[model samples]
Target: MFIESAGNSLRTIPGSFAVQPTSLQALFSKLPAESLSAGQTLILEGDVATSVFHVVTGSLRIFRILGDGRRVITGFLHAGDILGMSFKSHYIYTAEAITPVTIRRLSRKSFENEIAVSPDLGPAVFHQMSDEMAAAQDQMVLLSTKNAEERLCSFLLKELQRTLNAGALQTAVQLPMTRLDIADYLGLTIETVSRTLTKLSSKGVIETAGRHSVKILKRGKLAQMAGDGDEYEDDWRPATPQPERIRH
Candidate 1:
């Protein structure tokens, strides 16, 4: 079923501009699921990245495990977000699931074979890679800032943008991760994170829609607080730096 039409919809995916879905399916057909449980390790630093993954369900975390064994959450993998970054056959970070995950795994040889067979898929994959790199760069800029409130504001703004459509922005976006997760992602203390949200709400930039939800009322103010100048709307950033290199 995955092979039928060779992934017509995959090529059309917003970031997957280069994936020749048909070829991806052809290559993916050779690889199978590893049946990962919740909290399973999918890949780790310094290990050969011999496989690629397409998440079927559940949320996956791509993060760096520090020397002290603390996890720095990089990003979450939902139903989309292809998990493949090939560099000298080694993975820089690791992938684990916040919940039980099912991923379609493809070995490097087979993964590359599909690209070898179909020239179009390579460019498509390259586009997707570039997009991911751009997003990562933006994340670095947010993390690099010394201000925790600024970082938290940026994180919330980004999330809200993701939930918004072109018409009118929603009152709030649903937060999938908890306050601790937000703190970890923003490199802030939980209390600080909570306070930052409170400040934003008090300023009328955002109003609490409900528990685990937020609605934007004064987006312009939120943008100012995030240190992102207000020219673009709907979470558009003036600039997000690209990561020159990410340690695997």
Candidate 2:
């Protein structure tokens, strides 16, 4: 009886505990918690948009399926990032919890009602969306870069800084996304990404334990290794050849 009680008390991911926006807090004061397990398909591309989710805990991996049915991981969304952004069209990509997740469910009707009432929310959401777009442009540069090491380094720096800005501590940056997801997102093969990570670890720039655990030890050296260590504008550009356009 005691053990079951303790187990039941475990915190569930995606619960109402994650909702933090001042306006959302007022709306879902009575909202209940729910769970989304890792590797479970939460949504599919083209699924009709009905409800949106507010991640209460855990991480979500966003991926899109190619025509050949291969899943390409676009990015990983951590706690508090909005999942559904499009209303005119359905979800552009599918999202799955990479870890156990909990979320507060918001119906379109409820969200619209709130927006209608609160003029502040619309601008806030738009600002968030614009920020996401700028991040995407950064990724484009990473993707097009020819140097594998440069690309890997850029990815690490960006990933770490992003999480730190989102409430994670600097010394210890948790990689909620899998290495394979990182490789795929950066356009590197799994083996290459693994090798690069091992190299960086051995060189004392980072300390990696297993796949998802990463501790950054030397920030300056890593930025240098990626050619971005120098403050000069020339060093920021990738040293490798440009990627060729793949005709779809």
Candidate 3:
């Protein structure tokens, strides 16, 4: 069954697994559950890919350091997301918890053994991999072609969809990641992200519920800015009167 939390909806672990719950549970019953505090490193770059994680709660940030020691955030893994799938022996990027997290760890050998018995598992894994790849490609386009405003808009729209899925079209979405995390992911400076969000707020495209929550007031306009077209116009409604604008 699905439940809403932190402004996003998520399924139970079994449902989220995208496989027969009984089969998945029986296949990895020996694996233990692990917990990490916020900001704790779950997996480091270049570490052996011994196990894959299934997120039961919270989120993780995947990032890498450049030659100059600058951090580049690749993406975030939310509740129900999987991590540590690698073709190589080692992981390419580090993964850390953005919030207190709970995960189920399945060793690679065990995972492979299960797949050997259930050939259908291979296709499910492939589908998950393909979804992640498509998201990566979309990020590439956002970074290469979009301006700061467009990038932020695209990020907000995409995040809403990822977290809320069907409810994303019209809802107040909570951003689990910080502004700095978003700046890193979008390849923009913190100041630029703040500015873009301020501009959006001033224009009544969005309203700030708090530091981390945003009510998308003009989904149609925001969608258009994000290059998603105006098909969302029918769902658009006048925004609530915003508070006095404050310069960041």
Candidate 4:
């Protein structure tokens, strides 16, 4: 179900935890939406963790800058993804927009208040955090054991799955981040990332749709190369089976 507020909309994906519309409305009504241009920094490392952000549209890159000035990308956040759930007072990574984006900002205090008052919101947050933790563990496996080809294949399949789950019908998966960002996230060099993508396109496993998109052509083969028996299996499932009610 979808909820619309101030010309921006939010929807919960099927097969995932559902937060009641009333809870979401109460939470979001206290927050304001902001628009950001590509390359804009939303939050910086060492900054106070005062608020959390919900991606209403576009994508964000979460990364940490090392002392030597190397940027290590931790993950990518797409539409419906939430960030700033750190238990520490300061953020460890910086969040930057990869494309023109719209985001709703909920202060830490407001979020805690909502969770305390709304029973559904607390469990929904917990489920989302658990899902993120599982994803991080999978990424660790990819970085530690998977080869370059396998890593690229895994990344593509996961992105395709995420796009599909977001209700996108097209085969093209939007890649708003730069090659450097992807390289950092996958623990590969930029050259390796470019070469692997080129190889995949040539092999007909995928096709390049301009600079910022890819279309998967041979999903089964790609999944095999990633060492997964089938297409990317998601661990994210709804905490409850109840139908989501949209609040107008």
Best by TM-score: 4
Candidates in order have lDDT scores of 0.60, 0.63, 0.67, 0.69
Tell me the deviation in Å of residue 55 in model 2: 0.8
Cα RMSDs, all models: 8.1, 9.5, 9.6, 7.8
Across 101-172, the per-residue lDDT of candidate 4 in tens digits comes to: 886766666556667667777776666666667777998999999999899889988787777666666678
Positional deviation of 248 in candidate 1, in angstroms?
8.5
In the range 133-235, model 3's lDDT, one tens digit per residue, is 7767888988898888889999887665554452344668778789899999999999999999999999999998877888888878999998878756636
- lDDT for 244 in candidate 4 is 16
What residue runs in model 1 are displaced by over 4 Å at the alpha carbon? 1-38, 165-171, 209-211, 234-248
TM-score of 4: 0.82
For residue 229, give model 3's deviation from the true position in Å. 2.0
Which parts of model 4 are misplaced by more than 4 Å?
1-26, 231-248
Better of 1 and 3 by lDDT: 3
Which candidate number has the best lDDT?
A: 4
What is the overall TM-score of model 1 with all chains considered together?
Answer: 0.72
- In candidate 3, position 4 carries an lDDT of 13
Ranking by lDDT: 4, 3, 2, 1
TM-score of each: 0.72, 0.78, 0.81, 0.82
In model 2, the worst 10-residue window by lDDT is 1-10
Per residue, candidate 2 scores C-alpha lDDT tens digits across 1-248 of 00000123323222232343355434444567567677766666666665556667888777788999777777776655555545544656777778988765666556665666566666666666666777778777767764899888877776666555565544566787777888778778889999999999999988987777787777777778776856423212223321111000
224 Cα displacement, candidate 3 (Å): 0.8
